[model samples]
Target: VCVFAVKVGFQGKEFAESFEVGLALAVGMTPQLLPAITSVVLAAGAKVMSRHQVIVKQLLAIENLGSMTVLCSDKTGTLTEGIIQLHDTLGIEGSPSERVQELAFYNAFFQTGFANPIDRAIRDSREFPTSDIEKLDEIPYDFIRKRLSVRIRRNGDSLLITKGALAHVLECCSTVETADGSLADLGPYREAIDSRFIELSNAGLRVLGLAIRNVDTPHLHKEDETGMTLVGFLVFADPPKADARETIEQLRDLGVGLKVITGDNRAVAESISKRVGIMSPVIVTGTDLRQLSDEALFQRAREADIFAEVEPNQKEQIILALKKGGQIVGYLGDGINDASALHAADVGISVSSAVDVAREAAQVVLLKQDLGILVQGVREGRKTLANTLKYVFFAIAANFGYMFSLAVASVFMPFEPLLAHQILLVNLLADFPAMSLATDSVDPEQIHRPRRWDVGYVVRFMMSFGFASSIFDFMTFGAIYYIFGGDKPELFQTGWFVESTLAGLMILMVIRTQRPFLLSKPGALFLFAVLSITLITIWIPYSPFSEKLGFVTPPPMLMVIALGVTFLYGVGMEIVKALFYRYLAHR
Candidate 1:
């Protein structure tokens, strides 16, 4: 109407004609309801997720969970129980020994830093010496060195006892404890220690290398960290949760792959990954990562499932690398060191027991530290995406088809096809039925794979479905003009309003589910709302309120024609829906 009126105005008509036409034309379509519907749907999904212990801090991040293709998770607290146990203690040469536990217990027990699970385990170990130990000084754990050193007075001398990653502590030692009860040059024992480290790691035990240096001076500088004697290893075993393997398989089925990024030994990380079904053949360490350029590391990151010996900063880099490889990544962590990687991920996920910095950096938080709950969250996220797309795709296509038919009819008809108020009444009534879409049921197959929006798919869906609706709109026009004698203005408006509103409401049941409407049941509230609104929409033209709204009671014959056209239009919509989904599957 606006385009026609503008053309007429250019040919010396009054400006008022163009302005009025533009207003009527604008009121005829209600596409602006799309944003309102989207917000409600996302908010509803967030509410559902919260009941299952998944809290969505940001409304927008809820949908990103469905789109996540890669989840980079820390081994502890995510894949396994975060509780560490002192399972075994091995000497540097071969057999079980007490000196390694003696040194490790003193280093862990005398620490002034916060108590972690590993430290608690060591201090509580049965091998802890009964004798007293006093700490004179301490060097706390740092991400760069990945170890901690404590200076304690032992036998009238200060010994700097260090405990950390096996390779790191080995680098600080110049001698290794031999089976013969003597110190040997560490160079000859390097391969044996490394082999033993891998053996322990493969058994799914976290190994902390122990070393000590005798210092005559009470105070030590950074230079005094080296020239130590490697004592042995403290092996800790934090068992995997019972449901972790099942959760991993569920995420795998959903196409959300899991990767383990941990500061533990490569052997331990790989062992845990294998037990949880996230292991890949190649195990990449922080030292190995340093050898690769950024571009090479990105490629390696895509295939490697276990990233071991990763420092705090390196964990963030691995997340960034996966994202650079065109994967939407989610980071699950609960430690201060995990804060950087969590913040850098597409969806940062943390547990309820996470440190303040980690929880604050994360967008999604799990009240239960279980990956099984994450699978449920992912399903809900996909449901939100699938239902939101239903509103956008269905409403725009159906509304555009109805409006386009009105525009084409205006060129030849002598009277306005639909008055301003009549157009709004149809839009308002149709919106009532659409409100139920948020709680509507989604098909099980629809959520089997990760879902994200595709503009090309939207365009194809709208064009195909919109054209089908237009064909039926023309059928309604033919019936109104030829059979019903809708030459009268009020009669024509009444006929189209009934047909258009019924078509819009009926299409909801068909388009909302991928399967046939009868096969899947909608929520009770939704079913009740759509049925009530649909019945009320049909009764409006015949009720006394019709007079106030500029509607006329159509003849019984015309009502029959409207219902028939709607039935046929619904059938056509179902066919188009099937074809569209088939195309989507193939595409």
Candidate 2:
């Protein structure tokens, strides 16, 4: 609009001035470096994240990481040590039993189902003598049943061993074995089993019930799991990492809420959450979630921080619910049960050692399952996004002012505001500093909270700063005609060229940060790039080669006035920026 209006509005009056004003507006209004700058910043951030032991499968997800408002993390590998150890193997009487350990080993080592940390831990413990044992049939572990059944032939006798969550395993057992190798009906021992579970769980130990039965059939099925004798319990422990609490606190300070979604029972999840500094987090179980309507769960998902005993599919449900409630969610997981959740989250994060399904579904894969590394990734992501926004603010504000100034000057002045080549040179030179913006250091305040694209804020920024810049341009216009003698078109063009380039460069520095420009300095590379570009811009019009570009020597007063205007504009922008931020806050 600026170019077409200026061209048509002036062409009827003066052809030369119309051509100059139209071409200048066209060059000043277009932001040629924006797309290249955005790509460079995102690529640089991805490289930095890789240095912190993360692989970014999707480049654009880096920005999503910075924008993430909620992170749904699984308890086992992310917040905890990711190492499961067999704490104890106890008989039905809650006493350590070698027989129970032997049977547990058979089930753990011979199962055909997918292995997990618990299964690996059991196998890593004492090796049981099993030369006489022959593998037969197996019913693999499933989320619904929460158990694994393995039928084996030992000394020509077909026996089945089952192990899983206490409640589910207990349902399959008809009797309990006493410490004396005798069987008793399960009814009398129910209270004792409950007491033992409470005792172990209070200490934050995960308990799995073990049961056995003699089977006549060669094929094992879920139906054959009934009428078994409860043998013992397998206790496992995975403590929180040493830095887990600090990492959690750091995430909180960065304005990222943490939610733990695990298939573990509520007691264990609550225990780990408290240990990691999540005090009094609202807890929700799979059963509780199932009872709530989708709308109700969406509302509750915002308040609840710990989701326990959730099935594999329920993990995806929780993530979707959180997103539906208006959160940009990031999910971290490392197991088959986590694949769906990872796929459904806004940013899926998994470890390199995660199951193939989970890693494939994730956007980010860490070399180690540690929250510390993930926190570092979040910082890098924020820094990248901040630099990208800096260019946006600089280009929009400057171009807006540039085009408006050209339009206003074309109408009121007798000559063009700036020649076409002059406008392109100034625009390109002033924006060269922003090419190094990816290397600039970010203000701590800038990355303290998640950032998103706010079109309203961008528009307000452009209007406010652009209006101020145009005011400064008019000041230069007055000085050009009144002081430099605008009767000579060459003198008028040269003065405005120096003032526009120098002032544009100074404002670029100001808009890079919300903090007062002096307090938050840019990187060394950025400073050098700006200094080099500023020197080149000033030398262009005064050099012997200036004749070709329609430049003439300006009086020394013109350089002084340009510097004076640039300094005054910088000061005014600082005040304007501070007030702008304050207004935004109050609004």
lDDT accuracy of residue 273 in candidate 1: 78
User: Least lDDT summed over 10 consecutive residues: which range in candidate 1?
Assistant: 6-15
lDDT of 1 by residue, 1-587 (tens): 65566436544444564355446656655577778878888899999999999999987787789788898888897788878899988898768888787888888888888658888898888655536666788888888887899899867777899998887888899998876669989999899888887888889988888998888775767668899999888889998988888888999899999888888877788788788766465779988898989999999999898888887888889999999988889999988898889889989999898889989999999998888889999999988888788888767687878777876675456666676677777778878667768877788888998777778877787788888888999988888988756568888888888888888877777778778777878877678877787788779888989978777988998899999988888888988888888875447
Candidate-wise lDDT, in order: 0.82, 0.87
Residue-level error in angstroms, candidate 2, position 245: 1.4
Error of 2 at 470 (Å): 1.3
Global lDDT of model 2:
0.87
What local lDDT score does residue 217 receive in model 1, on the 0 to 100 scale? 74
Candidate 2 clashing pairs? Answer: none
